[model samples]
Target: EDALYQKLYASLKNRELATKDRTERNSMFARRYPSHAQEESKKQHDHFSLKAAQSDASVEASRLRRQQHFTELASIMKSSNESRINSASERARHHFATVQGEREGKWSNTRQRFDEIRSREQEQRDQIAEMRIIHSNELSFRGTKNSGSISPTSTLRAQTPGSISYFSNNDDETAKTGAVADRLISRILKAANSGKHRRPSEVGSVFESSNCVSSLNTSPSREKPREIDDNATDKTQI
Candidate 1:
């Protein structure tokens, strides 16, 4: 409060001093000049005052124009900055969309390839299963055939007990024939169970069996007549 009062007093004191100086100068000029001359000087002062007022108006106009120009420049700079920001944002958005599209396309292609591979794998599994089933069925069929062939021979032997009389006189020939039949049956069973082609030895064995059968059919049997003892019969009568 005191400083404000001091500043006010200083401004009033400056104003009073300026007024006194103006009054003294005016009084001195009044004393030096006649009435008409004073009137002429007042006219000149008015004219100079008018000229100074005009100059002040021109300076104010120039300052206003400079301020208006600065305001326009600021507005233009702000608009340019906004436009640049908008363009950059648009470009970023477009780039993001493009990258996403490429990623999605890659993912779709990978999924398609995966599906194809899975389908092929499933097909392969089905084929392998089918082949296994076929192999099992073939093995079972071969086993059934072997059993049927062996069953007939066994049934025949069981049904014809009296047929042994044909070879009763030749025990060795009967034994040889039985052993050959057993060997041939065993070899056939082995070939069937193995599920493979027959070897050369097995084929030769088949020919051997055929030859034995042929020889047996063509050869004649040797038989001896029985002799009676008369002394033993006569002792039994006595």
Candidate 2:
């Protein structure tokens, strides 16, 4: 191409040389084509910087997306874990409460049984003492009859001195005697119960007289007062 440009210029000026000096031509070519490689290199550098910036932006976007995803997943996992822990705690509390209730019920039942047994034993003791006093009173009443302080009318029995006989007739005097006997027994029971603390109904339970219709055949006053031996009164209560 340089040779072609030189020939065209020589033809235009009508000058030809077999060995032409190329200094001016070389200088002109150098001036015109100067630093094209450097410009291309600069352009390449700019392109590389642009590509690097784009790659960095893509990488930063991807990293941000990854962080966001991780944050959301972590939040979900944390919420799920907290919920599970709360559920477990609630179940444990319920189980603990159930066990506590059952334990309390068992303890209450056992204590109630113990109290019942203790009450029964105390009632038996009181009954035995009451029987002994009733026996002693009978002996004293018999002594009073023998001393003529009282006369035996309808109370005489074939078996024992203090024993009573049942009246075949339901006369007014016989009914009065039975009524007196009932009142006397009630008074004795009340006296025995006076020193103790109990429900009024429970203390009064013993005063419910024998069934009147069935017992009228053998009145309460007609009940035989036999001699009670030592320790026999306790057995009678039993």
Candidate 3:
């Protein structure tokens, strides 16, 4: 009976020791596996978040660079347009000034030419008036020399040397009749040379009434004919 009691006590003590060892092993496993899994999961989530942030930053920087380039190009175009407009305005102003100066110069020249023409016309009018006055003075100076002042009868008697004493004894009547006969002779000679015809009585009336020889000498005779002398017969005889 003492041996049986000793074996039963030993079995109970072994059972208690085995239960304690099992509880300690389950505690160690829970601490090792669950904490390692939680750390790995946290590391993966942090890496994914860093990559997403880098992509967002790159997209924003590219968009800002494009906006700056467009603004600079627009500013350059505006400056070029302003410069062209200013150059065009300057050219237009210069052209207008040149045209105005030319017009003024032309008007001045025309006015000067008109003044010269008027001066020349006044000088011509003065010259014509001076010529007319000189001609009138010359005509007034020569009016008295052309009128007949000597007596025709005395002039004819003085011109004839010996023919008056043979005509009549009264010298005044002989001078007057000689003057009439001289005038009639001159007129008859002039009419014959000029191809004009006159009556015999018209030529004979200027001579003295008793001078039949003088009347017959002054009048052209109708009964007797004149003979033409031939120069060819006289030259042959010479």
Candidate 4:
């Protein structure tokens, strides 16, 4: 406040004395002397006013010099404060980025670990299930092999016992037919076996058996069908 008042006062005095010179002051003295002829009093007042204006000029010049220093100090302080603020902001941003990156990395690693653990666990479970199935199959196969409840041979016999007996009877009947056919072929054709037919019971039985070729009551050995046909053909040719 005091500085501002002094500056204002100096500005007013400078304006008043800005154009002051010997010629201008003499002109003012001439005009004022004709109006009021107190030469000594006017000269003393003019000298005092000149001295006051010089003092005011010196004070104003000193204040303006200090103003230059004040302006330079204010600019330096402003730049320092701005630089400090910028550096602080940069540090804050860097810290935040680092923290965020670390947090995200930790989360990523944790997720990967969990997934790997789960995959291993799932694989272990599958292996256990496969082992259980293999063990069951092995047990079942061993039981089937060792147990005699349902063997392949027994199953086959059980399924075809009647059919097997029937086939055997049919084979016996074919053999009996063949034997009678042979006897007939020899008798009708007078073959080399006439001595056998000389037995009446054998001759009668041969004729009877020939009529029952489909019968399955033959206890005699089987004869080949080809041999029977050959004998018949020989009788026909004869």
Return the TM-score for each candidate structure.
Answer: 0.38, 0.42, 0.29, 0.37
Best by TM-score, which number?
A: 2
Model 3: which ten-residue window has the lowest total lDDT?
229-238
lDDT per residue, candidate 4, 1-238, as tens digits? Answer: 9999999999988877865765587678878686554676688899999999999999999999999899999999999999999999999999999999999999999999999999977766665555455434433322111211211111101123111111211223334434444444444334222212246676456646555333433333453122112222111110
- What C-alpha lDDT do the candidate models reach, one value each? 0.56, 0.57, 0.51, 0.52
When summed lDDT is taken over every stretch of 10 residues in candidate 4, the lowest stretch is: 149-158
lDDT of 3 by residue, 1-238 (tens): 7888888888887788777787676566657777865676577788877778877887888888888888888888888888988888888888899998999899999989998888866665554454344334423332222222222211122113213211222344444444544454455445545544557676455344435345323233333222212321211000
lDDT of 2: 0.57
- Output the TM-score of candidate 3: 0.29
Top candidate on lDDT is 2
lDDT minimum window of 10 residues, candidate 1: 146-155
C-alpha RMSD for every candidate: 19.5, 16.4, 30.9, 28.5
Which pairs in model 1 have colliding backbones? Answer: none
Q: Give the Å error, residue 81, model 2.
A: 1.3
Off by over 4 Å in 1: 1-26, 32-52, 128-238
Residue 81, candidate 1: how far off, in angstroms?
Answer: 2.8
Better of 2 and 3 by TM-score: 2
